[model samples]
Target: MYRVWGFITNYSLLLILGAVIALIWANVDSHSYHTFVEFPIAEHFFIGEMHEGHRMLTLHYLVNDLLMALFFAIAAKEVWEAVILKQGSLRGKKAATPLVATAGGMLGPIAVYLVLAMILGSDTFDAVKNGWAVPTATDIAFSYLVGRVVFGAGHPAVRFLLLLAIADDAAGLVILAIFYPTGDLAVQWLLLSIAAAVAVFVLANWLPRKLDKGRELRPNSTWVRNTLGFWPYLIAGCISWYGFMRAGIHPALGLLPIVPTIPHADRAFGIFAEAEKHLTDLLNDIEHKLKTPVEVILFFFGLLNAGVEFNAIGDPTWLVLAGLIIGKPLGILLMGAFAAHVLRLGLPEGMRTSDLFVIGCVAAIGFTVSLFIAAVAFEPDAMLGDTPVQAAAKMGALFSFGAAIISIVMGKLFGVKKVEG
Candidate 1:
């Protein structure tokens, strides 16, 4: 998996290239657009007949529920590895670059969005305007490509930037689950879901000790056996996610159980024990099976869901673009620098405060999640003018990506090239 990931990182351009090709094909091929809705599960089944949309496993649903679970789980695994398991293993110096930069990058965008929301909240335009926060997203693959590989891996700053970017993504997922999910939920489903969560919680707390069965006392039990002690928790988490979905909440919320509820490390191994040797391996297998088809499903939706049939980028387009491109970097850099200083967590070795200004600029390259929020935030056809919110989101991401690149080049002239120790 590490080799495969490295390969993916090394040739990220090709993955993107493939995505672009798929996107084009999806838009052009009518059959491709319906791919996500095609997977069948069931509805009101008496243990026999198949259902299409009801109990069916659609493409979009699978991507959000199953694949993204692994995505979040894997991310959790990475955070565990970086800060704890691999702590200071890197040449006897722990890397604070990503952890610091990511916090600043994330908080900055959220701050900008909140301020905008407050100011815009008084009017009906608030509905449309509240989405400015949507653009603060930083795509990890793109950011990693630009920061680490494109910028050169030798730069310690780039590695930190990548970590920060991933952390930023984790933050975004939290915000989305909290702020973006639909408020109107089916109460019965909600109750059932809660009931399930409680059940899982009880089982997790009780079952682990039962499974331990004096295993911890045995010498040379091996970490492998400790993992075997965790199956009940894993099973419980799966049940939690399924229940959450039935309860009218986003199923992504289900992955939450896998963390706090599941015991990744034994008392002896401690929480900081790197699960990479085992946990990542399990997640890697799940990720391999899940990511490909989910990607395909989202591509299908992107094509058919392109409701911008008659829209064109216009005046308001320029306004949103300005917010994302101009607003994102300035907000993130200022907040990040302030926090770092206040917290006594200084910048990376020889990296000046000004370099983050460019990093801040790059952070606004928000397309994927922005489009997601736009899809949920706006009604079927509420926004006025030629461009729909969906189109605006795509456009905003493009503008931000373009502007971030420009900022990167321009920052070199004004930013300190090297900092004196």
Candidate 2:
């Protein structure tokens, strides 16, 4: 429990603080808040949002586009380890039902969001249709915290929730990369990102180990590890980021290619396990080193992205909320039950079928990533009547905290028995 609270405090508390400040500031003085958010840090910068004829770096752009890459890289690292490691959580028969449920979690939101939009009339549907991916996000940190509260530390549903959230994140990344482009696609620039990944993997990682293969001392690999450390990868990451920016993909995902290139432990202790911090592999080392910086990045991310005015609440807002609150549980319940019973994959021991709905309620708290998706989903100028669609959609993401209460209530109503550690 202490570990879970600590993780939340370290990663989420600051973000909440930032969000509270932004909400207060935006409501009190929206004009000033907007000015501050768009304040230019640099004009005609080599890397930033294109303004007029040249790139200009704003505080919002700095936090959202540049620094946020670290946050996503951390996410990518967990996903990579979960998929690649020998004892990974996302492997074998144990993960089949949860993986299938993850698919439903995502698909359900899209179906609900789009269907509701269409019902609201074609104009509203066309205005907000692109934002379908916003509600599919399951903020891993907040959802995990809420899950523990509802299900207790010993519940199998808690682990199942974490698995679903992680898989949702992996899928969310793919959605962002494929469905949302920052600019006109320039396919050729992606070659630079690929080249950087391959070069770093070979020159910094593969070669050193290859040279020390037969040697007991492993002097060459040791030299690289001790002397050079993370520099090579950092340089490669910068190159990849540039490539992503030029290639019109979200730059925040640039570090993804580099994450797999880093040396990692052969076995993972799971994302929330305390044992993970003790791992000395380069991947873990980089993640630990990045913890503080990523926390700060997330703080600004929340502040910059979550400043929708209270009046901005409109159709898109209800649409996003409906998708998360209504769609998530039903989707998970039906799909998870099918996978467990129909497919014969089965739920984890001690977890009842009814618990799947409760887990879905917990997973519906899509605060962070949902906010990000909303920001990228619509143009700043895009509007539904007088309300900005992006701002309204972001408001829905913020309101997803309501799902925490819904999860707790559903947990009790469904007669879920808490299993304490």
Candidate 3:
């Protein structure tokens, strides 16, 4: 039993377990699963006398809006450290090729989606066109798992894919912000969200030191610059999350603005990179504390969100599959090759273009964030009431399972072998 717990906890096996359970449960008794997901957490409530704006919370809403905010917070911190802080392979001109390749990853899917949508022109395709961003996301956890399988634990191509996924996530955040908003836009709340993020940044990085003075303190003290010492971050996170929620955007994105502000050691080189040992970066500390909670949250996330009825599959399904499996890899390869020739860039040592090709295949797995985008892109309302376009988008997300198989096969074809730890 202890060994089982250790294995599942070690490599995000719990997350996979959760997704598999959800799929099987939903398929076996979809009505029960659906009812549970939509089950209200609280009774309906109203502020004004007319009860004009009453609201009720549901399980799905809580998981996606609230818990996933932490997930995005972790993602935002990593991206900030990598791209802006020059951590990981995103540092110098030598890193320029991968950065460009990241752009290709985004543009390629979008371009393929558009062309396919145009060719398959109809009212049906037009209705679901907003889902173009769905195929663009790379589930950082699953992609990392597949890459580890394909290229061992420490291959440079795996590092390259990690950086690529981070950059892809940054791009996805932008796309979500710009393209997907709920209801009429609230400018005041948007500004408030920005203010909250800035305040969090300042509180996390500056206030602790000002309060601490120059006194030498034990490193283990909660009052010292550790996780507990940074209580203000939790406050700031909540405020920012509320701000985005009210501003009619996905609240998961609330974490992005505050990440760069957290004090951190300089970014490290390579995948699975570590921060400076002796020095404490508050963001790094927060990430460490969040490790287990994030895993738990991801399990629930997969459980609640991955439940898709087969009837939801529609015209949008094929388009999404094509973009993820075909466009994603092609885009990565073409962009990397372009940069290598035009700008005279080279792959990380012992890495080759063929290895990149396999890495690109791994890039095709999209879930979590992709499902979130699908939900956002096909929100139910008058024009599309009770339709399955949203369901089809989700079906495509589920189809990303095929991308994993493709990666493994392509890895073998390219001579990749499992490395013993």
Scored by TM-score, the top model is: 2
Per-model root-mean-square deviation over C-alphas: 6.8, 2.1, 4.3
Q: Against the correct fold, how does model 3 do in TM-score?
A: 0.85
Q: What is the lDDT of residue 111 in candidate 3?
A: 84
Q: lDDT: which is higher, 1 or 2?
A: 2
Higher-TM-score candidate of 1 and 2: 2
Q: What is each predicted model's overall lDDT from 0 to 1?
A: 0.51, 0.90, 0.74
The list of candidate 1 runs beyond 4 A from truth reads 1-62, 65-67, 80-124, 185-235, 259-320, 380-387, 415-421
Q: Which residue ranges in model 2 land beyond 4 Å of their true spot?
A: 45-52, 382-387
Tens digits of per-residue lDDT, candidate 2, 259-338, equal 99999888888887788889999999999999999889888988887887899899999999999998999899989999
Clash statistics: count for each candidate? 6, 0, 0
Using TM-score as the yardstick, the better of models 1 and 3 is 3
Predicted structure 2, TM vs. truth: 0.97
lDDT of 3 by residue, 187-233 (tens): 58878767877776555556656665665763333354545555766
